[model samples]
Target: MNRPPSNILGKGWLYCTVFLTGAAVMVIELLGTRLIAPFYGASLYVWTSLISVTLIALALGYYWGGVWADRARSGLSLIIAIAGLLTIIIPWLTGPVLLATDPLGLRLGSFVSTLILFSPSLIMLGMVGPFAVKLSTATLAKVGASTGSIYAVSTVGSVIGTLFLGFYLFPVVGSREIFIGLGIALLLLAIIVAYIEHRHLKSAATTIPTALLVVIGIGLYPQIANSNRAESNESFQTRFERESLYGWVRVIDKPKENIRLLTVDASTIGAASISHGENLLAYQKIVTLLPALAPEMKRALLIGQGAGHMAMTLKDYGIVTDTLEIDPAVAEASIKFFGFVPTGKTIIGDARYEIRQLKGPYDLIILDVFTGGSEPTHLLTVEALAQLRDLLTNQGILALNFVSFLDNGQNATLASVAKTLAQVFPHQQVFIADPDTDFNDFIFLATNHAMNLNDESFPDSHRTWLKQRLVNIDQSQGMTLTDNLSALERLQIRKSEHYRRMIIDLVGTNHFIR
Candidate 1:
């Protein structure tokens, strides 16, 4: 038997094609999250949908590609080229697809949107692997070597893609631009491969103009979409917007209400009214009560600086406030737009990690970190709480601002977190921002010393309200949130879903599209 031709292209072109296709696959997966996050939020449900869709698409593509390889070896380039083109089209379609499905709820809406926008491109790209193996193999004897070599090359490409996109591309460029760049890269690769395999000048020539048109369309889509969103709601205006390592950050100004809102991944993290120049959110205002409850308030540490409203408020009371904010972009925006001044210091890093390295025996420590509408589970663990406790002075107080529902079964996370805090601090007090509402801020104040709610420093108006909402000290019993057993993510999802529904009802679906 003839050794089917020792080489496909003289020098390693097949490997390069496989490598590029691999890179494209990972790019789609990573950037897909950012693309949908603004509409559905970057929650467990959104991530789960994106991953599940990619796997299912790849599985179907592998099967179909194998069958196609048996029938037409020459069609590999055409298949990949078409897939690249389709990938380009996906980003363009994202806005419309999300708008159409916004009413379906986060879980179902995200799943349907992922299926419609991402599956086709991923399936097509998945076909490249099996097809590459078929084309590269010279004979039955070398099948194993060919398969292994192609896969190894593809795997290496995936690693490069993940690292480059995550570390470099995402931080520098916006999500929509990243998608556009990936699509352009893939389309160019497809044209090159087609020319190499079939010497098809005619096909490549046609593809060039089509690629140009696609890029132009992508550039125009965002502007048009923004205009449409603005026309939909004249009262709400996006004052500032930027892509950050964590997610999309936006500062929206509601001129009618004289409020400026800070949002990360569609969750309202902070809001300050222009008229009062203070945090408009009820939960944030409640954090100010900490200084009144604690015995001493000279030095304070804030774990999260959402627009720095709470920190600024503390500064006004003559306390030295040091804020630790994870996202530098958020910290910068807070100062520039939200009246956050560096009254004491602004540390940029993770709250949990920074807390351990701090030289602190602070009089007050406030925990307000959140991501995608929920507290990060890592920061709520028993071990983390213990570390924070050690950073406080003997008379210091730790106040946590979190959102949870207090209706029996829905209060598991609230109970667990309070239990964990109690384990670290002997004396603890619970205050719900609103006693009438089940879903609202649940502030937990813990200290080694007993807290006096009747202290003269307490705000006169809030004294009675805070006293009324204090949970019975005996009721703070439940499973503690140790590092290993934290269920904050699951609990937060329930509240996030509720928030999504409320927003949709109040503003209509267009509120989410931008």
Candidate 2:
């Protein structure tokens, strides 16, 4: 029992391999959300599935890797090489995995899809740590120090990986390219280990084919992706599509229907009549009628600028519309594809942070923020509502576009939001896109003073429909959502499922997988 002789790699290369694998694990985990988001959405269920699967895979890998390492102190290179291969094939496997799991529904589909697409590579990656520790250790005396140093290096790599990938890589690099880059890095590591351990040209030469295959895959990816998208979506065509810090931003056109849709992940945030250049969405139409409530309203603050439809509507009423949108890509798409021009300041950042900086005495503040059919829970809190209330003029109105079921049993998120708004603004009125359906867009109009909906200043066109959809919300049902206490994700599970099914019906299942 002596230490294994090393020529090519030594202990230093072993540590480097561990660091790279650790980074690979995190990059894969983060990228999983982006891949699955188009089909299943970036919901609580999707995140839960990915995180749980990563941990479960790691646990299994650690146990099996330890057992295997004890029996044979070789094959670390084979394990790394296999993991690299699996990582390389993930993009290829993604569409099939998503299609197969679509029938399972949101919760189960997301879990199963994540398990199928990522678990193998993640499990293989997890094995690297234990094997590296065993290979690097010279004797029983140095085992503890070796284990500590190895894991410390791995953790440091994971930290840097998370920061770099989330901040720089995602914004600039395509997910496919990033995946290919990671696979290439891992393959190189495996080759180094193989050459070091076997001390022969053949050992390193075996991994070269796999490296070339990955290069070929990267070159052919654009064709594969375009073919898939075209084959899947026959009815509509994509005008613009790109990945942003927020989610997948796509502008789709339906020639038959003559409508262009602005979609973020699985949710259709906004839609416009292609020939007319007017908003086509029922929710947007109703939400834009906020100026009817306050005739003299001169300025408005829109929290979510989806295709700039609402901003455009407000501007039509001679109101200066300042838009706050989190995703820059969405803003760009709005301007380029939908012809959205902001009359006022166009601030691009999270609503929670940006809301504070605004020197707003806004006449109307429209909060229409929705991501993948779920609102950011932080912005729905009572504390957040109060900040918005401070910005409103004395006779100003706050119009919140919420999508949920009308039934009391299934309206936890809606009720909680209504209750939260009540804590800040004394007067409130709720309206729905369609009162007959249980699931509809619920627009909550809150004001510091009385809402004069009966005023003669209100237009006759939308007045009749607005009065018909007006409904009362019983805030007593669910506890108010506060900064300290909010479980909007759990509350919106049923709504998310319904939303996903509707999207599939509207756009077809193929549009989601890509």
Candidate 3:
């Protein structure tokens, strides 16, 4: 890579082009995920598929362009012209493709969404390199040098793109606008590159096809504006559809008790409902139903808050709550759909990361990180439990949600998790959801304080619910999953090789969660 050559673009222009192209690639790749993720779940599988398709397309472009460059070697003008086309087309197509991706995302799931939504744009992105090298090629002997330099530029561009998108672009401007902006930038660069080379336009035999393509691209722009129009139910009261780095957040206003928070990837989190047509600020936990559950409980934190469900619920119970959630889209959705109001102190980074970052002296923390079968493995580890413990005051408690099936009701994962919790906290008790209520779910209360299942501290409603149910422990069929608990004990085991493999595992191949 360091081998010197008879450089043509020189240190200045060459470096500039490399950074620009590299930035474009990174923008397209990373931002493309943002573009698609708004419609689909921003799961690792989705990322794997998108990145895979892009890499494959790039390899094909490399091969084809390497061969084509031999003949098309002297046309910097042609290269720029095509790049320009890409710029225009990409912006124009943004709305259509993303809109087209919605129902398609639903039908195909996140995996297919990645392919259907991003493949074409990624392919277009893939073709940029070969043409750049072909246009810049000075001599047959310098082919390697030309290609290397262009690629170096493209990579640097990518690094810039990544930093820009992650830190500023996503947090500030909307995702749709960013897509359009990048497209325009690419188009201008292409035209500029062509003129800088002082070359006339190439005579294309198929001008009509080219014209049609441009027209089609121009038509795609409006799709961006229209893709975000209204609620699926056609309710006039619904207001917004915003896209973020994580996914889309839509707000629907109805004469209801709470605003509904919907994650593009999962089920609804919470609803912003109205009381007597007036918005109520009260949290709806109704924790008073369980005699054992207390309102004046110590400091509290909620992980994986969707529209501030647990946070608001706990807040209703008079517990000081802190929330940590990964997606900003979800946070926005909470304000837009659910009546839950957060006090701006809610952490916006990845939940686990933010939890580690916080200066915690919390008395209670709610663990709802499990996205059903796709629970975060790291959070279930002993180390994570220990960290949570570290943040807890002496009497602090952790409320964990464990899912269970209604049929014959046996949960290996919950048992395993319980085993781990027992290791962490000696004073722990479990409150299971009604067995016949369809979900064999349980909420494990872990704290240093002696919690009384029959304590007078329970709210009247919670006490009534607890009074009707009997506490039964299934010591027979279960595994307490902990950091030390090996996967072999479960019926399913993971042998994943990469992100793609892990996704497949999430879908279950004799794996317990699938």
Q: Which prediction has the highest TM-score against the true structure? A: 2
After the best TM-score superposition of candidate 1, give how far the Cα of residue 290 lies from its true spot, in angstroms: 2.4
RMSD for each of the candidates: 3.5, 2.9, 7.4
TM-score of 3: 0.73
Best-fitting candidate, scored by lDDT: 2
lDDT (10s digit) by residue, model 3, range 343-452: 43678877557777878788677787553323456677667888898888776777776554333434454556666777778877666566455344466777776866
lDDT of each residue in 133-207, candidate 2, tens digit only: 888777789889988988999888898899999988888998876886787677767767776656631344445
| Ranking 1 against 2 by lDDT, winner | 2
Off by over 4 Å in 1: 1-8, 200-232, 370-372, 408-410, 454-463, 473-478, 504-508
Q: Residue 385 error for model 1, in Å?
A: 0.9
After aligning candidate 2 to the native by TM-score, how far in Å is the CA of 80 from where it should be? Answer: 0.6
Which residue pairs in candidate 2 have backbone atoms (N, alpha carbon, C) closer than 3 angstroms, thus clashing?
none
lDDT, model 3, position 102: 39
Model 1, CA-based lDDT: 0.76
State the weakest 10-residue window (summed lDDT) of model 1: 2-11
Tens-place lDDT digits, model 1, residues 1-514: 3233226364288789889889888999988888888778877788899999999999998888888878864555666766766776676677789988877877899999999989998998889888888878887898999899988999899999999988888888877667766766776676677666555212343345544544554565455333424244677787777778777777877788787888776677788886776777786666566666663678989888888877778877788889998888888788888878887778999887888889998998889875337457889888999999998999898888777677742377677777788778998888877778887777788889886768777777668878788865334545778888877777677777787666545335555553
Per-model TM values vs. the true structure: 0.90, 0.93, 0.73
